[model samples]
Target: MTRRPTPLKQWRLRAASLALTLPLSLAVAAANKPAQGDYFERIATFPVYHNLAEGEARATETVAEITTASSDGSTLYYTDSPRQRLGLVDIRNPEAPRPAGFLQLEGEPTSVATHRHFILVAVNTSLDYARPDGVLAVFDIRDPRAPKRVASLATGGQPDSVAVSPTGRFAAVAIENERNEDLNKGLLPQFPAGHLNVVDLAGQPADWRIRKVALSGLAKIAGEDPEPEYVSINALDIAAVTLQENNHVVLVDLRRARVLHHFSAGSVDLHGVDIEENDRIQPTASLLGKRREPDAITWVGPLLATANEGDYKDADKVEGGSRGFTLFDPRGKIWHESGASLEQALIRAGHYPESRSENKGIEPEGIASARFGKRQLLFVGSERGNLVAVYDASKPWSPRLEQLLPTGVGPEGLLPIPSRNLLVVSSETDAADDGYRSTLSIYRLGAKRAEYPQIQSDPKQLLPWGALSGMVADRDARKRLYAVPDSYYKASRIFRIDAGRTPALIDGEIELHKGGSSVDYDLEGIAQAGNGDFWLASEGDGKKRPNLLLRTNASGEVLREYALPEAVAAQATSNGFEGVAVTGEGALERVYVAFQREWRNDPAGQVKIGVFNPNNEQWRFFHYPLDQAPDGAWVGLSEITAVDDERFLVLERDNRSGPDAEVKRLYGISIAGVEPQADGTTLPLLRKRLVRDLLPDLAASNGWVPDKVEGVALDTRGELFVVTDNDGVEDASGETRFLRLGRLRP
Candidate 1:
């Protein structure tokens, strides 16, 4: 029952059903074409924490990894490795998803596939990486709240991915006896190779038939390892498997339980790519002959699509991983490869993970395809970037990018339910310290605009940009602005932004250097000096350097430095300067900077706001009020700017992300006739006036609200701008929002 086609170059896809809304001719031209009818919108977010029982550590780590939907699309099931449990979510309303419950298991659950009324889970019972043992368990989900494990069958290897055939009579599991990266520096050739575990489900799992299809001796590179990573069974009962570490793809006939064909996934010479892991993203570098070490594999019509996670295994070369996805035919001939296009698109959205430059830039780790309405859609998940690229693949030969949807951290699984016109992503990363747990992001297709990528690099330049911290608009230009990068990169940079663009464009970088080498500064705040220069506030971690303010030219060359007073410098901790602004002029010119969080020698619920006079090199501060803290998170001022000589704007926020994010606002204060004391500790305090609640703007995009709202600037046009820090995409969605908060009235 295989629909295997000829070589990629020989086979041609007939026009998709003409019934589709748009003619195939025009559909091919769409680049994430504007959604016509109801486009996907994130109506609800369910943190896996809801599944933990009363006695369980609610603060403990839990994640929704591999997931599957009920045939009716009303229920969702996922595997949580850290908790060693299978979780359930109810999405009957599609607008508000809630956690149903969880079932504990003896081992870590790797993948889940649903067949009829049964839920099939591959559980890894391995005691060591060298010795792997797993089992395929069938659970009766008649009562989703209390799933009953009815049967279990032993397998020889650890399973990574699983899928049930559309016929509901076949299921395939990729038994990947994965490698021990700690051993021999993760060199391959570890034997007891892996393969596919096929089961015929005529009825209950107890009465099913099984077979193990060996995947060894197929690829020349690490052929003995045969690390099968993912599997997907198409409507024709044909299964396609990806041996990621082995750099190969295999297609099998489920009816006969035999391998039909296998071939190398091959390699490519990547150009215009970012190639460093030094906390910076420079997307202009190039790589030679990088292998497409794919991870997730999905069936797209008669062809197969793979996410090139770029998990290299060839010991000969130092570099591995192709930064995109590929489509290959049964003959193993490469049909189409995304190459650098995906990564480039990510850069424009300011979602590029610069911290992974030494490794794969943005790992396209998961792929899923579905037929919704008249359109065939393909969704690709970027593990590091924390977003999925959805495509209109109705016309197989020419697919257009539709939109990028933000997920929680490490989106390990992608699920598409065409029946309900819904898309789901299972993010696997859990945050214990930040109160933000792993989440299940649900998107339903409807008549709504894709409200993401609010900020991106210019399409022409595609300047790789992320980790935005400080923001300052041009003094004269109405729509021009500049943003500062946080400590994610060793290089301190100022990015030019044309806020006028639909998706604000980052024109290019203005490198900050001292003596030609990049300056080592944790820049958190910036203010235009109006003299073709900017004043920068560096947030010293106390262990590294003292908090200081510096002035730099348009080229980002350091011109002057203003060291903090000895007493103030000694009082500085890790949470020092967070924002800076220039006020007054000439002799009366003064610079203002905000201190993040409370430090030593401060009263409870109050922090210092240092005010500096550049002319006299003198410093004074005012007591800034701190609000009541969240349950377990801390609150602090992330940015401050002078709205005018009499008024100044301050940004107060909490250090929490996603649903846990609550307070993000702009407060106003005036220094009108306020007496400044010589002693920094004796300064008077000022009451804050509410100006704007930024929570609405953040939620308007239908994306997760990030914690680090570290920049706020009032431009000469009376308009205000805000920017968020993405933390270098490290445990972050890597989404930087550059917002133009239209002219402030006060």
Candidate 2:
């Protein structure tokens, strides 16, 4: 999403593609189906769910994370990294999870979470380490029914995780602090240690209340608060026993308006702790054993773990570390010494006699603790082994390994839904390798065995595991699993997975115009139009250009392609647009598109959005100039729903400018004037405008630079949902992601 004076190569590609024109029949045929046996061939493989052979997994240089959610506990949200947006599926009936919708994001999203009322997302700023920052977005889900964003927040550094409080009063964010002095010497000031921030949400019925807090301050007063009183809680303390420095976790206490703690388990220069266990009584114990007899031990916890980035030995490495998890008590107490201390202790003690030499060692990057069916379990997602290691956390002081489940690529996130005895594991492909595509490994745990001392320690089988198509975006569902594919240049595809059955590819491709990247999947963002028709917004292109307004039938047939206005097109600079919502009554229906302009050298980089009147088939474009607003770059615009007639909520990018600029703003836009057409369709005429001079509010704010904004949707309550793309591009500052704004209040 980073804007770089419109590189010549991209322009050449665009010009080349535009110049080439095939015969109408040939073009139509090509679009309908890809050539058979071609590398990019389109196959009609009945969506199958099963484990892939180790050799069959495709590798990607960089595998971003995927997020999803579902209403009726049957749908799932997903995104394709290469495609750059989110997709949905109906899994209520496992064997036939239906394709729902595709929602686009400004950049690439690293993490995704969903609640009954909203979908929350954390996107990585551009892939550039020099420009580190991310956006926090919220979607309204009042309609488990149709989901959309109601509010959003901007955070410095890559956002790792987001959690909404039970009361939905606030959102706690964990921002990854990976900025180093060396990398930021000439960039803007380095971010203070990556810390947790809090967004003060307005009440449930209101829009998002955006705010931020520092972790240093939260750590200063950790003892004075209750477990759930904080705005957001950092679980890294527990994770520290296993995470590396480049992979720390931030805990925010929203209720207390402070950060509770920051845990840096692995770092470039240090190696963390490693724990092991033994159960057999060896005759050799008498030769070296002290008064403490280690013979009676039947089980062990965290048999071995370490925290550091895995590339510690590589040359030109900016960071040093391996990955592993730490241990903490139930009350959140660190059970082991620092990683340095533990590593030193393990080295001095030498290998234990009971330790097996053939056991594969792992550097875990993801850690989770949960209670399932009366068994307290600790799960470690490993980057080295690409497996999920399960442990008994019944006694946090001494966790014991129970089982290990093989996953594809580098396993990162683990979501366990005990209500259905399901485990959803997300994999991040190695950035340095190819043929390693990302995947979501779903495992069904068998009946618990009672023979072991700890419920989690008993041998349990993992059954019916499935590998989903494409990398995941955000997943949501109550019983079924929903997913979206990962693509860079195409619209995302949606799929549904029914429990105990094969998955179904509901729709074909959800077109998001030319540069769709990051994607957010929220509930209300998807809806049903008349006679099985569905309407979705393509949030404009990232280069500040018009986007596509997609209309399709229930089976995923494109009924019409509404060309957006140039004003709207100009607002979506390089970070192609996202965020689409539908509102109004039948004949007078309206669709709003949020414009996320790029920051160009021009003094007046602007954002122009479009509103379509489906009934009359006409379009009216709105212009938001950068020159008039405080911080004009409105990156991610999630939703645009009507509060009532004549009044509308326009969610925008609201935050502080990056190193080159100042304040950021997010607010609402008012709509008036309705026109009807003879065919009952609202179509916009094609009129071109200077992308840089359209929005006065945008030009004055951020000094006119192209921005990448993405994601948009409308909730069932008539609220809007918006998100931005953080392209995760290398070395580019700012998340390829713009901002995400959800409109709930009129």
lDDT of each: 0.80, 0.38
Best by TM-score: 1
RMSD of 1: 4.7
- In model 1, what is the error at residue 35, expressed in angstroms? 4.6
Task: Output the number of the lDDT-best candidate.
Answer: 1
State the lDDT of candidate 1 residue by residue for 58-129, as single tens digits.
778889999998878899999999989999888888677777888888799999988878899999999888
TM-score of each: 0.92, 0.39
Q: In candidate 1, how many Å is residue 166 off? A: 1.4
Instruction: Give the lDDT of residue 641 in candidate 1.
Output: 82
Candidate 1 positional error at 539, Å = 2.0
Clash tally for model 1: 10
lDDT of 2 at 684: 28
